[model samples]
Target: MRILVVEDDAGIALGLRTNLQQRGYAVDVCASLASAWAALSSEPFDLVLLDLGLADGDGGDLLLRLRQARAAAPGALPDPLTPVLIMTARDQVADRISGLNLGADDYLVKPFDLDELEARMRALLRRAAGRAHPLLVHGELVVDPAARTVLRAGEAVELAPREFALLLLLLESRGRVLSRQQLEARLYNWQDAVGSNAVEVHVHHLRRKLGEGLIQTLRGVGYFIPREDGA
Candidate 1:
């Protein structure tokens, strides 16, 4: 999934970006609330890792803005329902309550465990996708996002990071069509060097490894994974 990390500390931001990227997540960093707002105003992000103490403004202001943007014209603003996880040094009850009241989906104090953060992230993403289970299951294809493993026809399938990301995204949006642009946006970050046919190559690889009918194409529109019952 694509993540926007709003943090001011250079060391913390770099560490988060590097670690999350290694876990197959596309991450973008914004050092100040202004930059975070700019990025949010222009693009779509699956989740936000917000830090309360930004250089320019309080992260809660950004959170409130994001939540209040639900009335914008369709596609004109960022998704108001997009999950936000507040990561900050504030550990008091009032701070946690205030952030939650401002539409932060989850909160983690600084010096938290990376594993716990990832678990919380997974939970939020799963809830956003309307899934209750951590494992994504579509017929015989079982995907474990935490484990980064896929089981097809009762056998383990090895997929590259991009391929895995593409598969998970398709599964999450099971009946919905996602254009190449959408796939590319979620699969790669600004720092990655990507080829023109990167999504196509990864889709081909997924189909070959999993099954020919696993991912369906729309010729001109987009791609989608069929609903579980083949709808």
Candidate 2:
């Protein structure tokens, strides 16, 4: 999972980035709301760790803007419904209520335990995806999205970043075909030069890593994972 950390305190931001990275999450840190806005406008993220007090402005404003953008159009914001967790020094009951009312998925005060923060993040992510657990099981294949790890028949499978992402997308959208264009858009950012064969290459790599019949191609349409029931 990818996360954006909006914090002005250098120590806190660095610690957050290091800890989250160690836990298998791709992280980006910014010291101000402006940089956070720019990052949000540019790339997609699975979640945001927002600090209320920033170098330039309050984080609540940014959260409001993000919620507003999500309400405007289908794709107005990257991951329009992306989960947000507020991490700040403010601990008052009203402050917590306000942040929650402003669309913050969860809130954590400073001096919080790293383990608790991680647990909260996982909970919010699972809730956003409408999943009851962090593990996604499809027959003999087990995927832990939070850990960014996959196991096939009790054996761990190592995959490149792109391959893992492709596998995750396919697993998440099982029973539905996803076109090359849609896959490229989700996997690559705007700056990436997506070659015509980019998706095919990744798909090939994934199939080799997993199995031949894992992901089925529908000729000119797209690719999909066969339903677990084999319907």
Best by lDDT: 1
lDDT, model 1, position 99: 99
RMSD of each: 1.1, 3.4
Report residue 136 deviation for candidate 1 (angstroms): 0.9
* TM-score of structure candidate 1: 0.97
Query: What is the lDDT of every predicted structure here?
Result: 0.91, 0.84
Off by over 4 Å in 1: 71-75
Name the TM-score of candidate 2. Answer: 0.79
Score every model by TM-score: 0.97, 0.79
Q: Could you give candidate 1's per-residue lDDT for residues 1-231 as a string of tens digits? A: 899999999999999999999999999999988889889888788999999998888999999999998746755657789899999999999999999999999999999999999999999999998889889888899899999999988999999987899999999998888999888888788888989988889988998999899899999988999897777
Which run of 10 residues does model 1 get worst, by summed lDDT? 70-79
